[model samples]
Target: MSFIKKRTSHNYDIYESRGHIIGRITLLTGLIFTFLPPLFLWLVYGIMPPSKELINGIISISSVMLPVSIVEILAFSPMLGTNAMYMSYLTGNIANIKLPSAAIALEVAEVKPSTEEGDIIATIAIGGSVIASEIVILIGMLLIVPLSTKLNNPVIQPVFQQILPALFGSIGAYYILKEWKLAIAPLSVAILLNLVGDLPTAVTIPLCILSSILTARLLYKKKLIKVTD
Candidate 1:
């Protein structure tokens, strides 16, 4: 048993090390490709926005996005695992699409996040979702002109808005039911904060994460919740 455990640990370490290397390389490549279009226009046509306007635009966007980005990394990394995080960020639509897919995948696989099995499952799930989304997007593009009228119909607009809320609500309910004690603190904090005033997601996300962590620690300390290996 000891030898088997050691071998498993060795294999997992190698898996994680390779995951990091590949994730970093792909992410850096994606970043370079992301900037290539603007660089092309600037170099080939000498076409670029005014320096002052560009600086202001960047600051305005970065101020909001930087905090949110940092918070998302901290909040989602544990649940997403390293490779899934890199893939989801590279593909975008993480909150609405990739996150829910990963959550559902983990639940179905009966694997806890941040573990070796969970990491592998999540990476595979996210990869599948990315491909599925691309196919859907391609079909949408092909059909968009024909379906434009119906898609833009007032009655259908409300349904589109509710999709994300419904998706998250179902996932939240599942976890909350499974571990209501752990959910209480963060849920209460979120509700109270929202009731007081509408807090930006950047502000609320970190607070919620902190509350959940503290609550879990307190529960474990109190022997209210048992930790399992």
Candidate 2:
């Protein structure tokens, strides 16, 4: 028996497939993680107005850019879940405005296989679509420039280096340290990362996670520690 699959069309139906609770969890976690840092920073700034750092207006706009993009994204997501070509053939059929936008986005993101692999094509397509959506938003912002706020004043950059990491570390230490064993791995890895002059979280977090999991497993296996699910 062959373990090969056939070429499937990358249409709206791809997203149409239901029941991805893991994806939902990821999204919810995003909603939590992305906001909390900036919020705490804003609060701290408000409280003791940093001497060197001025919170510019653009930063404020950039801060809420997520919720705004989310609102726009939700407002225009397609409902029909049909092929883009078919949708283009009959764009008027869709009763909703958001459907057309989402359809357009799906069309933008669909991969056509070349000499390269399918995954590469899909990655390019999806990345292109995200860039396109951001471009559209930027265009909209330009149209209403007076209404738009400033983001990332130069003054805040240096301050961010100190405040952002401290905020995350403090919070993680507070909540995740309840389990002392789980706590040690992060502490160790954090120190390691700092000593190594800082790799990205992409490298740092996975290392810590794998180390913690293995440490926990080993300790339990040797009867040095107990695990509770």
Candidate 3:
């Protein structure tokens, strides 16, 4: 009845346990720091926020974000591996930076995600990515005024604007093609949802993930997609 899987490779289990223990500690530390500013204000300055307002704000934000956060944790952890999860979450910006970096590293290493080798690669990738991103941010901040001015130029604006879409599209396209059958249901449903109107992204994301999982299951059952033992 252990949450961590019992692996034949004791080293793997040990590594996973260590990672989870550290990750949880880091997560808790982060949560405490996140509320530190408000707590400091209340204690030191007596600038206490209204409890009713705080409750309402928490409810409003959590209603949209909490479920998405849960889904993200479940969906990304296996693919990212435990150490990578700790690194990526600690640094923030997973989808836009850490995920793509880890994916590329795994692809380059020819390692399957969720495997021991993948865990190492993911940890390295995320760690390296976090370092590189921080360096880039530091450099960008130093030249912020000049960089912002240049980036805002009409000629340069479109490139900056499309960067996220382009990056995700290129990386995502490869996986989508690799598992086209699995992609079809989710893609179609997502498109339909978009056409219906502006659905909250939190709702859209989990729905798409659920649809993709269901489609994959059905396809496997129908023998359209193979499930290897």
Question: Which candidate has the highest TM-score of all?
Answer: 1
lDDT at 170, model 2: 62
Determine which window of 10 residues in candidate 1 has minimal summed lDDT. Answer: 198-207
Best model number under lDDT? 1
Give one digit per residue, the lDDT tens place, for model 2 in 1-229: 1323222333322542321343455556767877787678778775545644546755655655545444433322332222221222222222233233443443455532221233333333344444666687788878766543333557566875887677656656543645676678757987888899856544665566667767778878888777332
Candidate structures ordered by TM-score, highest first: 1, 3, 2
What would the per-residue lDDT of candidate 1 be over residues 159-207, giving only the tens digit for each residue? 9998888988987887798789999999999999999897777688788
lDDT of 2 at 67: 52
For each candidate, what TM-score against the reference? Answer: 0.85, 0.31, 0.83
* Global lDDT of each candidate: 0.90, 0.49, 0.87
Where in model 3 is the C-alpha error above 4 Å? 1-8, 41-53, 152-160, 227-229
For all candidates, the clash counts are 0, 6, 0
